[model samples]
Target: MNSSNHSIWFYAVATVLSVALGFFVASHYSTSEPVYHHAQLLPQPRALPEMALVDQQGKSIGNNLWRNRWSLVFFGFTSCPDICPLELQKLASLLRLADASAKLQVVFISVDPERDTSARLREYVNFFHPDIVALSGSNTELANTANFFGAAYDRSVIIESKLFSVPAGIDMPVNAGNAYQVNHSARVFIVNPQGAYAGSFMPPFDAPQLWGDIKQLIKQ
Candidate 1:
């Protein structure tokens, strides 16, 4: 081959090798990525409204608490019959399995503020995960917070052998004993370290699946 031809061939070979190397690296990273089950990454992150809330220790927590670390937030009441307990237990197990260095934070925001006081929430949350933070506020505060996340709630009271609506504005059905329940969507919100809504995990969160997804976030 002529010198010019040889130079061109050598350059082509180098370029091909470089491209191959890049592909290999990319593939390796992709395969090593942790697999998440039942959770989808948001197309674009959404912003949260400014709402005031108090933590287990009565510490103010809201958008400000979201700063500095990733958080997994859930909204439920202490009186929740089955779903709340099950979810909390599963999360506790996952936390135990996750690496200590990862230090994932979990927040339980109570939708039933009428029954979920700061003290009650603290005690309830501590039973499942000591590291978990329980947050609750007055009815007005909670309503504002819930509205920000589009969470709907309603109160059903039994009066004079029939169910009647109280002054409180909630979105639930009427039931017996004035013991009404709040039905809300189950979404495990994943917030980025910068307090941005990273994504959300829907439901049927197996421990392994959650661990994998959370591990991926920790690495990121």
Candidate 2:
């Protein structure tokens, strides 16, 4: 072939090789990614809210707490008789099965700080797993964190009190009895090492599926 034709042929071959390498890399990357059965991975990660919370020891934990490691956070109150405990148990199970090097942690953020004191949060969360960290904050701080996580909770009300509406400009009755409950989302939030909202494992939780997802997330 002429020199000009040889040069054109070489260029065409190089382009074909580049396109093939691109496809190969993409396909392998996709296949290597762990498939999640029950977890919902966020399409776009979100920045975690700036926070001011007290740990079980009454130590202040700022936004820096969300940094350095993966956090599995659940929002609920000690008074929640069922869902909170059940969800904690599931998380505990996943922790047991998860890879030891995954660098994951669990957090219980109380929505009822009026009742869930730092000591109270510590006791409640530690019952589920010794590694689980409990957090408490003022009502405004708690509400802001919960709103960021898409967790909703109503004001504490007496267990036996009838459903009543508060008039505009009125505040929720804070003296709700010991049996008072703060309804909240049972979903577990995943925060990445960079302190951003990563993804979550929704209700009807499966420990094995969560374990698999956790392994994949750590790889990410």
Candidate 3:
């Protein structure tokens, strides 16, 4: 071949090789990714916001508590009539299903700070799972933390023997005299070992499916 013809052929072969290499790399990485059956993995992990909260043991904790282990976090209150207790039970089941060596933690952040003191949170969560970390904080602190996770809550008020409407799907009895309730998000947030907001699982949770997803994430 002439000199110019030789150069063109060489460049064309290089381009083809580059394209093939790109595809090979992409395919290899894609297949290696863990598949999740229940947990929704984020496109990118998000950093957690600074928070000041107290755990059930009255110990001060913050974003650092999320580091070093995978966490399943739920937002609710001690006085919640249905969703809160049911979700906590689901988390307990997850912990039970996890292998002993699984570095997983369950966190319950109480949105009803006025009623859910550190002591009250301790008793409430211990009933469901002794290892569950129950956290309560001042309204401002709680709001900031919840907002970071996209969790939301509101306190129901009793006005002259009339109970304000609770969130739909929450069953609050009319005769809950002088007892107010909290309406909050039921989705369980997931935190990676690096303390990043990784993903979430929506209720009604299937314990076995959740376990499968968690194991896959742990392996990754």
Top-lDDT structure, candidate number: 3
Residue range with the least summed lDDT across 10 consecutive positions in model 3: 167-176
Q: Which is better, 2 or 3, measured by lDDT?
A: 3
Candidate 3 residue-wise lDDT, 1-220, digit = tens: 9999999999999999999999998998767876777788888999998888899999999788998899999998888888888888888998999997788999998876666778899999999889999988877777778888888776676867765865422334455544776778889999998999999998776889899989888878
For 33-147, candidate 1 gives per-residue lDDT tens digits of: 5466766777676777777888888788768777776778787888888888989888778788878777678888887766777888989999998999899877677777666
Query: Pairs clashing in candidate 2?
Result: none
Best by TM-score: 2
TM-score of every candidate: 0.76, 0.79, 0.78
Model 3 lDDT on a 0 to 1 scale: 0.84
**TM-score order of candidates, top first:** 2, 3, 1
- After superposition, candidate 1 runs with Cα above 4 Å error: 1-35, 164-178
For model 2, residues 1-220, the per-residue Cα lDDT tens digits are 9999999999999999999999998999777866787778788989987798899899999888878888899988887889988999988887788777777788888777767888787888788888888998877787788888787777544435575433212235655555554666778888989999988888886788788777777776
